[model samples]
Target: MNDPTRAPQRVQVAIIGAGPGGSVAATTLAEAGHDVLLIEAGPHLPVDSAPHFRRDEMMQKYCNGGITPSFALSTSMAYLEGCCVGGGSEINRGLYQRTPDTVVETWRRDFHVDGITCETMVPHFEACEAVARVSPLRAPAPPSSLRLQEGANRLGWRCAEVPRLVTYDDKPSGKKQSMSATFLPRFLAAGGGLMPDTRVHRLRRIGGRWSISGTRRGRTLDIEADTIFVAGGAIRTPALLKRSGIRRHVGGSLRFHPMVKVVAQFPEEINLPGMPDPVHSVKEFEPRFSMGCSISAPPLLALTMAEHPDHMTEVDRHWRHMALYYVQSTGGIGSVHNVPGFRDPLVRVQFSRSDMAELAEGLKRLCECLFAAGAVTIYPGISGGVVLRTTGGVRGLPDTLRGNRATLSALHLFATCPMGERGDRCAVDSFGKVHGVDDLYLADASLLPSPTVVNPQGSVMAIAHRNALHFLERAAHGAAKPRSSDGRTLIARSNL
Candidate 1:
């Protein structure tokens, strides 16, 4: 690991945040012989630093120890982000999915994004998947995952195994293709620099160069870059841009997939003690909502059962018969704001009445599916929720989910800084260059125009890869020119 305190004071390109986007951007640039530096606010730990979804992993990898929450009118939704070298990829299940063609059309029509079609995005996705070794399970799906497929089959709903970014070697649980294990290493091999445990507090344009000011181990730190890529996930990316006094259409329109989980008790043993997360997901009701299984580790199971204290003992005695499942819907609007005098930003989300109704309906459908898969009892993730033993009992679920009564959480967040040519609504241009900023681009989830309605790591990497290549091509063609004070340049133009 390179020491942040002694890192170089300047670079040709500085990529902020070591998440999926940043990792891909840094690797692509470095492999092309650019002087790139990847900065991470969290420590650089090994990919297998701790067990997946375990408490120790949360403490070591997750931001805020896996307790980040966004407040709403009558409730708050907890969300998790990875803070380590690989960011969320270090913690997520690595389920991979390309951005749907319908989603691409929406972005092109709504955000006026150019050169973004299913055909155009294919090469980028294939490049990323090739490097990350995206593959299907070599072994049979775990029993827990099979339950989802069986239930969907019985209901005649579309269900399929989601291929993960893993390198299987005759094992059910294969090696995770996290950033730390893939792109970051490739970047380092290509002679890129890494500065972990350095928190960037602000970005300033100084004399046509980007000045990155932050702290490292209680000391002031600064670096100069001829170009910069802000890949600090969705929330922090907007917060950083806003903090740097670049707030035009930045954080105004955030979107995320809100999900509610349920603990289902099966008649037979299905919860294997050391199994990885389920790989199958029901896609029949997609675009609005979807259903999938979750990690049922003892601690996670206990956390999901907090509302049903009376049935807490069930986790201890019948854990072998229990697994966790969720219904996720892209039905919430949100914003990210930098809290004055605080390093962390504030997130506010609002769910419409229709959003709540959709969630309730999703919950009911999830319970029905679980019962069809042979669940004996299902515990809804609600403050005063009831236990249902049969599909008939699913009708007892509420028509609209009450904010204070239901437990809601989200794993996917995006669009705090949407990309497009629409000056009225876009923070960055169609190619990810910030609208009024020069030499500064966003290559993360923040550039996504809207919710992907699925696991977004694949999309994030593909877009970042595409945008970085675009930057390189522009530089090669001498299209990168300095701007006047009215549209100041953050980084100085450099000969590639």
Candidate 2:
């Protein structure tokens, strides 16, 4: 608990949001001998605080109990963000992939992002991967995962196992290499200070420093820092900046992978009781879309089957045979707005006609692959959707999904505060320094110029590593000068 009456605490560097990006940045800066304080809006807990994919885990780790949604004129899509210390890394499956080379080139071409190439980013990615212990499953993948590969092989579609940030020790189920398990610990060991359950409400430029106004356990808390790094994920990072009156290109171009799920039931016991999420993903579509298996825990299956009441009982009886799969596409655009009175920001997303058509086609293709994998029955996630029992049934799917009936969700979100040299579009400069704001930076998914079309944690961490090093280099050159509240210059540390 923080004392409301205490004087404002000052630090050399303050980082908001103890997620993957913040954790990586904090660890790097701290190990370089900087005074860094990492703050999180949620409680700190062990990685295994709750079982993965369970309702209890959602309540414990997810933002808004995993019910955060972005409203569109025609429909709404639910997206999950982690509110805990480790952010999404603690709750996600830890599937890791570098930003595709094509995406990097596109960012450089379209957003004017500089010094970013596949080759230049390899070292940053390798550094983060080494810390997270990223590796593929040493043993054979679970049966559920093999089914996706089998289908892709039968159809001659490209598919392979996706590596994950997990530490394998001759066991089928390995420990997730979440921020709490990896970087956060390193940050702490390097003498970084951590303050959990501290929600920063706004940021104000005070002279040459940044003033952070926040609350901890409902008590007002204030902090002044010579340099500030905002890593509050995609949505909140932009929202916080918007509330602070820094609205240019902040949250205006949010992007995400619109995903639709389906529950497939096989005749055999395909889904084991404690099986991990399928590691294999069909990458035949690449940037346009991708197909992968998802956690089919009984609770999740119940939610996926809620529209089909008649099939609810199937979850209880045939859960061992049912598995969940998803088709996610890099379509649709969204924005984040701060409502005057509401604490949470309003997220509005809109999908175009072409986007709907693509999703419909992706859904049909997903069903075709599932049927090829020997699925006996398929339950689409859309409301009022029909169950398919044969390969020919896919032909009956709508060419364009009905906006009012589609049930869509997204796991990856980014580009809310894009980093580039384009002042007309970008919120931060090439290295993540906020445009026109000295010493203020962004080190999260918000800095992504566009969607990576894949799991983006790896990208977020690597970019953060790159940006943090840049900040340190600048500080070493005396670009960052510490200041006190009274506007007097303080002694600068020579550690960096």
Candidate 3:
């Protein structure tokens, strides 16, 4: 059966999901005078925006924001994520940091992605830095952040002001649009077009073209474009590709930044209650781990742990005087696959026991650092460990902390549709072109290829910029096609 909207509206490029990656790609391609159409799964915000984020509001607009289930060892947790307009960036705290040099080396050596050094990525990072206006998060360090920095400084360990991609103004009173506002506008101004409230349900290969079949604003639509770039993030991107039967090492190999956040109550309000997050730090513990706190706990997140009858009272006492804290761990590859007799794939994360030991060490270190900063009281978030008033009193995690489930909540999911050299057991090539699928592409955090070990917005955007440059150049002036060592025609570039 042919799609109803498959009237064959061809374009130089058809980008899926107008987030940072797609926005950058569209902007670059359009600026190069290529006719591009960007299709999004959600609505585009007004030119000016304000935060009207309510629970229901977040759910209707976000993908499983309020009632999403993520597999924890024996159970599930409600995970919140933004799916509309800017995807994660619209809802994320806008923390930006470059991928650590060590991580780059790993991809270079272990993953065989040539020319992936910090120096090689410098041009790409600089391009994105200019457009995204990347800068170190500016502000007098809050006592809470200062405490962490001071502890690290006193300990003679490495730490720095985490760079974030946000415009700071002393006079600002409310929420501001970020990537969707920044890159999306640039993309549109550069002659990019957007179709929102549109969901591409599946992809069907017809002749030489890939037809995107879906619905938009209550009408069925099918789009025929020369190329399709999937940027639906780590989860949906792989899911959609698998649904479309485009598997070539896709729909699995999931990796993520699993995090644990604790609320450390101070004598006074540490972080401005309800204010936007300003700092996201990754100190000496970088390539292996990261520590940055949340400004406020999400409701579902809060209730999930606090509602436990065992510590209801203590959790309440701590909530009133809390400062957000986080410890992030790099996960080994995990996966979700379509299960028999199930609508969605089975999702599982198997953090090595060795990794767990490392996380325990980091947790101990974080608590120790907080105590050093004159925190009069300490809360060991370990499930059964009594909230510690004297930091030294709690020597070890309660048996509860050892549970596979209900551990520190982590999200920053990535690497399902990783990029590498062709036939490298991952989905895409270094330039994000899906292996064996000519003209099909992937953008978003899903293409990270490995764990970034920190909040990865900067690296993701840079890579997107890099791939978009190569893709756009090829579209406009014919990409240099590579051949076998014997000079056989390996891959050919065709009309846009």
Estimated TM-score for each candidate: 0.95, 0.95, 0.86
TM-score comparison, 1 vs 3, better candidate = 1
lDDT of 3: 0.66
What 10-residue stretch in candidate 3 is worst by lDDT?
487-496
Off by over 4 Å in 2: 1-7, 170-172, 481-496
- Give the Cα error of residue 59 in candidate 2, in Å: 1.3
Which segments of candidate 1 are over 4 A away from where they belong?
A: 1-8, 170-172, 481-496
Instruction: Please provide, for model 3 over 1-496, each residue's C-alpha lDDT reduced to its tens digit, 9 standing for 90 to 100.
Output: 2232435455646788877777777777778766677877876664234444456556555675543566656423234555676776776666677787988887777767756888989888788878666555444655567666766676676767765666555424322446676777776777666776778878988887678888877888767776788887777788889889988878678887766555565676565444545374647776667776665544532553452446546445565455657677784446767665654455666666656666676766666666665565555445553465556754654322345433455557778887888475678888888888888899888888888886777787888888888886665566532111232111111111
lDDT of 1 by residue, 73-141 (tens): 875788889998989999999999999888989999999999999999999999998889888888777
User: How much does each candidate deviate from the true structure in C-alpha RMSD?
Assistant: 4.1, 3.3, 6.2
Error of 2 at 51 (Å): 0.9
